[model samples]
Target: MIATNGDLERGAVDDQVVVRGAVGDDLAGILSVGHRTWLATYEPIAGPEYVAMGLAKWWTSDVVTDAIRKGRTLVAVLGDEVVGVATFGPQDDAVVLWKLYVLPGHHGLGIGSRLMDEVVVQARESGHDRITLSYLEGNEQAARFYARHGFTETHRETPGSGLPESVWMARELGEREQS
Candidate 1:
């Protein structure tokens, strides 16, 4: 097997819901939460097979570490347990939100929006003109969520090779969301 290029030791996680330093440790749990969140968010659009395969590759400890080290990743916690994870990173001159996930039970509680709010605030503070993210086009709920948060469909992207394709969304950070 080829060795992963992820630098597992280069990340430091902070607690978003309470204390700080909630990045590593018990990676299995974090991955489990990631899997659950993926299922909840992607199952309706990408199907279970895609979600499963993606989880297998994306939820690994190494991948998570690489993301935290390279991106702005925030972990949501209630006490000592992490219930969610969100990441923002530079992608092609825009700040892309790579991950914004919460456990199934944590949904509908504004947790996802809270995470997005934090990301938007940070991106704006960092002088990002816009933020972008992609989601399977078939996922209407997710599309609605992004729309509610002021993201507009900017383009469509296809990975080909049976990979799930998605719509790219962009929101201008300098503009305020209209009420």
Candidate 2:
């Protein structure tokens, strides 16, 4: 999605959300939304300690800033509030979706879908044939969400980090639709 001031303008039409490239200024907002989403979505399934450890190791401001700098991070905004975030980048020879999170309060608003659409568009534009991502096994919400978006589980592995088994999923990126 194109980044523009009009996209970030206040009083966005009701239920009208925009997905755009994240900027360095969005690090704190991204971190906050990510942490809140993780706590609400994963804390119960993985426990607070594991969630804390993962967040501390992965959601640092520096990491988010670097991703933004690389143009691999996208943020979903409604009015001036950030409701979701998606991050993806090249891994080996393919694009790997590293993170896709939406605030709990914003669930069911199609923010995740919009973010995934942007990710798919980015992957396709980057000349990738497929995009891959992993989710903790037993996360039915995540599994269903990805399945609905055309991703299929290809494999499972134990991360050996006190976390549950991880399920790897991938979706083929076919021809992009002409606008």
Candidate 3:
């Protein structure tokens, strides 16, 4: 938890917010946030049918537990309440951004960016040179977000859930911005 700071709502910060390493107990909250945010953000682009099934298939405590426990799971909290989360680990030869999501009400407040920035830092520290993630092709919102954050389209894919037209994105992590 990073103490709401100016990230969540601005001006009205939640003093108790925390950005911490998630353990098993936090799996449910992370999954809940993922489900809520995905539905809120992707439903418009993914459509009701695909988003609905994606939610049902992906938003499970077990799935989340498996994600977090596999490598590194980080959680964002607003005063004991979860607002966002991300998980990262090696995907074959590259570091993978397993998931990066922010709750609906907290969107556009830089929460997602912050989580991603931290992941990039960790990946760099770990000596990873590349990172990969994917989003629905129709979900231009997410594609733009990732592009703006330094990712580029590398390939198209069929989503694991059988959803059509996913754009696989990647970023070279070794490129460092001048500080």
Candidate 4:
């Protein structure tokens, strides 16, 4: 259950949002963030069935616990509430961003951008050259967000199960988003 804080280091993103690695005490809040964001964002774009499958596969306590224990999960906290979550880890030659989601109500407040910034910082500190992520092809918001963060389309994959295509994207560590 990752009883200790797993050491990705911690910092405040701003006066309102504290960005930190997940601890055992954060399991419930992290799960809540994931469930809420998935329902609010993906249910509309990917359908209820797809949402159900995703929640079952990715939002479980066991999966999140594993991520937290690995020191690869970060949470954005607004006061005492968990408003966002991101999980990433080494994949081949780069870091693969397995998950990144901010609560719907918190969108446009720069929470996700702050999370991405920390991800790039951490990846560079860990000596990675690039980061990779994939979003559902139908999710235009995600597409725009990743593009704004300097990610470009690397490829696409049809997951075949009536699911939307996955639009894979990557960004080199040397690049920075235009502010």
Stretches of candidate 3 exceeding 4 Å from the true structure: 1-8, 11-17, 158-164, 177-179
Write model 2 residue lDDT over 1-179, tens digit each, in one string. Answer: 32343344333322468799998878888999989988987887788997898798889988888899999999997667787999999987679999999877666667788889889889879888888999987788899898888888899998786778989998887734221
Candidate 4 Cα outliers beyond 4 Å, as residue runs: 1-13
Model 1 over residues 1-179: C-alpha lDDT tens digits? 21122411112222234322235573665687898788887777667888888888888888887766654777666555676778788766679998777777655556667678778777877778899998886777678888998999988989786666788999988777542
Cα error, residue 31 of model 3, in Å, equals 1.8
Q: Give the winner by lDDT.
A: 4
**Residue pairs whose backbone atoms clash in candidate 3:** 1-18, 1-19, 1-20, 2-18, 2-19, 3-17
TM-score of each: 0.78, 0.87, 0.81, 0.90
Winner on lDDT (2 vs 4): 4
Candidates ranked by lDDT, best first?
A: 4, 2, 3, 1
Task: Point out where model 1 deviates above 4 Å.
Answer: 1-22, 160-164, 177-179
lDDT of each: 0.71, 0.83, 0.75, 0.86
lDDT tens digits by residue: candidate 4, 1-179: 11122321224235568899989899999999989989988887779998898999999999999999999999998778888999999998899999999987677767898889888888998899899999998899999999988999999999887778999999998876653
Candidate 3: tens digits of C-alpha lDDT, residues 1-179: 44443454553443344677788888778878878887786777666887687777877777777876765888877776778898888877688887888887776666677677778887888888888998877766677789888898898866555455878888897665321
Q: Which ten-residue region of model 2 has the weakest summed lDDT?
A: 5-14
Candidate 4 residue 51 Cα shift, in angstroms, is 0.8
- Clash totals, every prediction: 1, 0, 6, 0
Best by TM-score: 4
Worst 10 residues of 1 by lDDT: 7-16
